[model samples]
Target: MKRAQHFIGVAVAAAAVIGVTSLVGNDYYLRIIFMMCVYYLCAAGMNVLVGFAGQKSLGQAGLFAAGAYAVALLTTKTEISPWLALIAAAAISGVCGVLIALPSLRVKGPYLAMVTLAFGIVVEKLVGEWTEVFGGAQGIYGIRPITWNDQPLTSQQWVWFAVVLCALAHLLLRNLLQGRFGRALLSLQADEIASASVGVRVYRAKVIAFVVAAVTCGIAGALVAQQNQYINSDFITFHLSIFILLLVLFGGAGSMYGPLIGAVILTAVDAALARWPSAQHFLYGFLLLFALYVMPGGVAGVFRALFKERTETEAGEKSEEPPKTTRIGPAGEGELLAVEGVTKAYGGVKPAQNVSFRLQRGHIHALIGPNGAGKSTMINMLTGVVKPTSGSIRFLGQEIAGKPAHLICSMGMGRTFQNLRLFSDLSVLDNVMLGRHTRMRNGFFSSLMGLPVAGRQEAVTRGRALELLELVGLAHLAHQPAGSLPYGLQRRAELARALATEPQLLLLDEPAAGLNPHETAELGQQLLRIGRCGVSILMVEHHMDLVMSVSDHVIVLDYGIKIAEGKPAEVQCNPRVIEAYLGVDDEDDIEARETCPPSEGRRDAET
Candidate 1:
């Protein structure tokens, strides 16, 4: 019902704008309206890159040029329809977007910005200096304009076309951004490692964002070239790129209405500055700086702050219902994970050396060691955060020694970080939903079009995530931002997120870190419950009580080497285990009197 209302509101607004344009019938006003729509198209796509995916690009102008020139050449030199030429131009520019995104895989921040900037400069030079194909400064002429019923559109008609196109773009983009696809992009922006650990393909998501930006910018360029019936090197410039960026940043890069808000206001500001070209760039510079330092979230952000969404707080809640633990993974045949001589080394430093272990399904195994014992390093290797120096790791009888983190996660291994790596800005429910990303069946087109299947799948995933939160005793806080929760709650939220992956083998790194005794006890029980539900657990913890109480089996490591492994009680009483925690005295240190008491040594180990 709310969705229907949203579309109806948009339709009514669009109709009013078109009605107003027809009534005014002024050439200058029509031109501004047309350009506003065109710039909105450009800014809409750029927002996916710079806002949602957190990849800053400055070469969008090159993509714009690709579309503009493709349309010009196709219409003036060939017999293809002008509309078909527009489609082709968008495809070409999308390919260019892929090429631009390749650098993002290796470089980021200013380095990526420079790479894209260089691409724009190269395209600008080619169009300006290459006379034969591009027409040099003379530019391409006689470009065919779009027509309806075999007649060229009038100025008012053109404005209407642009308005319709912008509306469709906004609607389609909103559909894509409000679902799993949108969540994946936002996840990328938050933390790539955490995103991948939840099964989001980092590079693929980046490329898709770039392509969205490129396609829209390209179409906007094509629209301009076709409408004017001419194109030139001057149309594609660094200033144009900067202006396009300003449209997103000044309007609110990530907000749904940011592009429209930016396009209307900034285009008007540009028109106001048109009389004095000398001062235009200077003022634009000032606005960009101001937006960066002051209005960082843009106009949309300010509006959001003024009309903040009401939320339910947990302040007055005395207690939550008892957790209903859910069934986790399928029954396992035998070994869930086997590590054979897995070693990770950095120059002279070896965090894991010739370590081997096998985790059985439906059991809780704890890896405990003092500080610097490589327990976390082993977890990292298993989850593909770090590549092993040598040896094999088999999960579900499949070799996964060097798989990508996301692929490793998809292959039935889920993990949490030693330090919290929650997508803090997202709601706790959304963070957990990201873990279900790999299991989702809907693809890009289905999500983009807001198909019924996509909605159903999203609803189902949300339900499952909420269930996972309940299992971890956090359903009451599902709607709250993950970062806003208290530290102990955040730990539970992260656990819920990892479990949403439905892993056969769950690897937890210091899951009880920073938790008080009561919280730690609850976490131990949660692990036991999860293990009973048929999921194997590999836990790295410094909390001795939690480990000894809940763990069925125990492994001990010291100075990058596995020293012992057995049943918890048997291993706890082992002489080597005691010695590793409390060093023995030699003849040279015989002045140390009697050996330290066993209770004191155990306390020292726990600390």
Candidate 2:
């Protein structure tokens, strides 16, 4: 049904384009329309980099210049066909994009802006100074127009060609962005840390965005090469780059039609004010300022706000219950993780020291301690968020202490953060979908091309994401942003997202940190349910009541050292647990191994 609606919208837009072509015969009007299509082609891809990927590239004119030169030099020097030139231009610019991305993608935000801006200035100055072949500031000329049937294409014909190019580019880009590839980019923009935790390659996504932006601008530059039959440094300036960027931002950065609508309005306005150059400049700047200041969300954003989807109130229906899981026992031989004297030091201070423990398959093992304790550090070392020093950490019979976080995640372990790290801007469902990144086999190319495997995987993940949401009792709000949910629901959403990774062991850090008594009770139920899904759990928490209720085994840490490990009752009875929580007067007091009554430590640990 959704695909059908998408096709219907496409048909409607196609009809509108054909209508404009058939009725408008004025040569000047056709030129404006052609320019609009040119801008549309470039702006569409800009939305991906700037809007969805949330990386700034302020020097797209360099990419445009690369393509433009590819076309101009190829056509004028050799006798290459103009259409062939266009394809070559796109390829050349793609390489240029990769070159820029190598260094630029290493940094982000204003640093990226400086890199790209430098790239643009360098390209412009190079084109102007290399007078021997480029004709310097004058640029290349005598370029052949894109011809139809061996004759130069008419204004009407060129406009139609541009329209076709714009339509095709828009369709492909829109398809990619609306799929998993786009979702991952959106995930990156929202929170890089959260995105990485879900297995997103942060730098790779940024590079892909830059490459796509370059390819589109390159294609647009090819069209310009043909239209004017002359190239100049002045034409491909930083101002034009800003103009193209404004087209995306002025319309709606991430939306499909934003570029098209922005291109049409701005191109037409520029052509209309052609008689007065000074006024044209003033009005153009004013419009950009107006779009940025008055309508910050852009034209498409404003339109979306006006016609936002009505909140769906229909409750989510329950599906068949998940089958119960087997909880491993301390006596069981199926051990999932073993840490032997694992320790992590930061310069002078050691947060985790000589810690050792083993978790059996499908067991709920809890790590407990007070604020300054080393529980958090131990979990990080286990999950590869931090590497250990002078110790061994093994998961599934393999050493994994120094592996990358995503590699550990792919190895069937999932975890949540101490303070909750949800991608607040993404929809509730998207958060879970991103968690399945390691499960996906498609890379940027396969997904960008919208291959069958990518599509199949996407559909499968979407269904599974909804199912996970349903499990968390949030399927009804799948379309809503994850951050907008209530505090308790947000935590539950994080659980669903983590579970989406299909891990053998789940690590939860402070899951019950801020919940009320009633909410805490609900949390206990949720943990029990999750345990029944055939997954083991490793938790670092301070909520003693909640921990004692659910944890089958407990490990206590204090000042980076393991104090005790046993069943919940045994750890609760240990005097060291009390000393760690309430404090000990001297280092010897903790080392002396004093014994105390069971009830005293249990109450203080709970407090």
Candidate 3:
């Protein structure tokens, strides 16, 4: 494959550089190369956290210190092998990463950054003031360096080792980032709520990202300390954290090669500014601002903009195929969901109060209500987006009230948002593929190592996603950005994504709100088809025509209370429903109801 060949070429080039540098490059140049590798290792993991997972951390210097100090103490205070000490250092840093991730679970944005900043400051103080163990500002010395064949490496050999490590890091990260794990991180960055609805464990993903960043940065710090045979608080500063961030921002954040580019460019610039410390700080600040405001995508983004990457299209596939009619869910003949005494109140403002409902397996039920009614609130509660104040919601005969959203999704429930929460920047196929997150069986390590199982799983998920796109009439736009599609197409794309979850129950919120008559008709057909595929649907829609056409049963709510429930015709003739919609006087209501037929009432309510 072209991707395999590209990786091979990169490896060959790296090996050649290593061999050439060992023979001809001086110690100074080798040292520069060594620093670049270290920074690259740091930035590669940070990219996952900052660029993909969208967690902005400013305490990476603390994690670096954890590794550097760990190696320093393990080598100096004990008789442990330097290599084992390096592993220990990484473990320590990983633990610290988990601790740092705790704050992220509870906070976000600047608050999270401030928490990380405080962590870095605390680590700095501990290293500088804990004189007996850390050597205070004077630092630890005489730490054992890593060895090869029981011999300490030469300066050139150190660079060679770093380069090999960098190469391996690149390959491993590429394997991890291009698969389900990578997509999960990206989905987290796009929208955590949507990500959770699609079965991504949002908090768990955040912790994993932080641990990754911590481990790699820890490894880099250990390498630096071992190579130098010394380490101090000076190695772990706020400025160093900023510099590590700059490496990602300046080179490119999300791209795999961005960290390498950033490490190379920023390391060289740092070396160039070694003579003027104040100017270096000022310049770094300016560059950070510039990178943030002027070139948000960095050098790699500039290249993408200039060259415009080739479109990802399936060759020789010009016409779209009809959607597959395969069974979408397990065939069943019992109640799928039951909501009893569900109530949600916000201190005197109750969106839903003592509501009860039942949805049969493979049936399409419609929840119709005007604006300010409790339709959306019911959907939110059912999907675990909002916990009920008091209720029992049972799905598949198990109580599910107040559970996490991701857990609810994993239990074979999928949903689309009323306001549209697609991962807009991702390709339509990817957005749909994300719906299969809970179904993929490969673990983090398998994906990280690019195991055959991971590849097969990804391929299968991709195929299924494409099929879903075809079903929704968006196959031609599968490779296009989801956000670029028209509103109606986006709605269909969302439907495709939800279907990719292969849910036993599908909850759609206002699926026809913005569609034209034809599109709504198509949607109605799709719903009917989905129902025939054995997937139960609970749709909250205002378009009465679509509801009447596709839904087997209808429930009406007005002012947070259920006003009527029955077949379309029966509900249409309910006096309570008529009074709720028309607000006619008693005499007028009686006279109008006597004259107006049920179909006319339905038409008038729609008007």
Candidate 4:
């Protein structure tokens, strides 16, 4: 049903573009439409970065210039076809994208923005000062126009070319943004720590987004070279990149129509302000400010609001039945993880000291401690989110100490944060698919192209994620924004996401922290089901009822040291654990002490 709506929306948009292009009666209007398409291409690329991946790259002008220069140089210096030149431009831009991505993505926020800004400046200067090749600001002229049927393309042919190119770009981006790759990028944007925990290589996702956006802008630049039959260094400017960004943002960064709407509206605005040439730049700046203030989500957001069809998420539609939960399989049995003498110390402050534990397959082990006892830190060490100051950690017989979190995840360990870390902007289904990142076999190219194998893999992944969601009773809300779910449900969703990794060992940090009694009971059942499947469970939780009920083995921690390790009942009765952790004194009265009461009262009576 949703896919059908997507196709319907695309058809409507394409028909609208075709209809508008057909109705343009003169060369002047034809040229306007052509320019609009060019800008549309640039805006769409920017959207992939800023909208989908949440990367703020202000150097797209540099990428655009690279593309134009590649096209211009290839066509003028050799007999290469313009189509081939465009592909070359894309490749060139992609290389440049990697260069920028490696250094810039290392830093974030304004620092990252400055890196891209500096890159644009550098590109502008290289073309201007490197006189030998770039023709020194005069740029390359008389570049071959796109020839159709062995002749110069007519104005109508040019328009059709623009339409086709824009349509193809739209189709490609649309498919990607709705697939596993897009989900990975979106997950990266939401929370890097959580993303890594779910097996997304944070750096790789960023680089892919950066390259895709750059290639899109480069393609647009090639179109510009073909349309004008000339290129100038001055044609690519920092201001041009800024305008393209504004166009994308003003239209709606993440939406399919965002770039087109922004391009069309801003193109018309530019034409309207042409007569007031001196004030045009100022007018554009003013308009950008206005749009940011009044319509922060852009024109697409406005359209959605007006039609009351604004999307929260594609997956979160109303469902008739409650979500179901799945039973874990027996394929995950045996000794899954072992930690020996693991210690993590910060500035001589020890959070974990010689914490040694082994998790046998299919057992639910509970790590319980009070605040500052380092339960969370221990979990982080196990997942490789934190490197143990000293010790050996092994998972499935592999040394995993200091391994990257994503690599550890790929080794079949899945975890949930003590604080819920979910991708708020994505659907519940997307969050679960994120857990399947390591499981996915399709690469960016295959996924974008929707190849048969990619489709089959995606179906398998989606089916698995849905089944996991059902186990947590969230299948009904699979399409809902994960953040929009209730606190208890978010915990369920988090569990489902971790389970989606198909982990032989699952580490849950406070899985039942915010659930009601009933929910907590259900969660225990869920954990038991997961355990029965042969998946080992290690959880740090404050809920004793939950911990005692679900856990097969219980370990007590006090001030970063293990105080007791035994069966849940034995650990509960251990005096050292009661004194150091449970805050219980032996002599406390039965009525007050039997169910565990105030420590102060017992001390007062004894004193």
Task: Report the candidate with higher lDDT, 2 versus 3.
Answer: 3
Write the residue-wise lDDT of candidate 2 on 1-607 in tens digits.
Answer: 3655876777688668867787888887787788888888788878888889988887888888898889999999999898898899999998988888887546877898888889999998888889777678878999877887899988888887887787678767876788777888898788776776777777777778888999999999889888889998877677777888889889888888888878988888878888998887787688778888898789998999999878855332333665333231122348899999987888889888888889988679999887778887887777777878879988989999798777888888888988888989788898999899888887666776667887889888888888777777777779888888888878988988888888888999898878788888888887887777777899987778788888899998888888899988777757677677776788777655455444534643553
Global CA lDDT computed for model 2: 0.82
Model 2 TM-score (2 dp): 0.91
Cα displacement (angstroms), candidate 2, residue 596, comes to 5.7
Alpha-carbon RMSD to native, per candidate? 2.4, 3.4, 2.1, 4.4
Q: What value does the lDDT take at residue 478 in candidate 4? A: 83
Over the full model, what C-alpha lDDT does candidate 3 score relative to the true structure? 0.89
lDDT of 1 by residue, 122-187 (tens): 999999999899987899999999999999999999999999998889889988999899999999
Better of 1 and 4 by lDDT: 1
Off by over 4 Å in 2: 275-281, 312-333, 442-446, 584-607
Candidate 3 lDDT, tens digit per residue, 1-607? 4558868977997899798886855788889889999999999989989988989999999999999999999999999999999999999999999999999889998999999999999999999999998998899999999999999989999998898888988888888888898999999989999999999999999999999999999999999999999998888789999998998998888988889889999899989989999999998899888989999999888987899867765422434456667578999788899989988999999989888888898789999877888999999999999999998999999999999999999999999999999999899989999999999999999998888999899999999888777777778888898887888888988998998888999999999878899888989988888888879999998887787777789898887788789887777777777777667776766556744555743753551
Q: TM-score for all predictions?
A: 0.96, 0.91, 0.97, 0.90
Clashing pairs in 4: 315-479, 316-479, 316-480, 324-470, 324-471, 325-470, 325-471, 326-471, 328-533
Backbone clashes in model 1, listed as residue pairs:
none
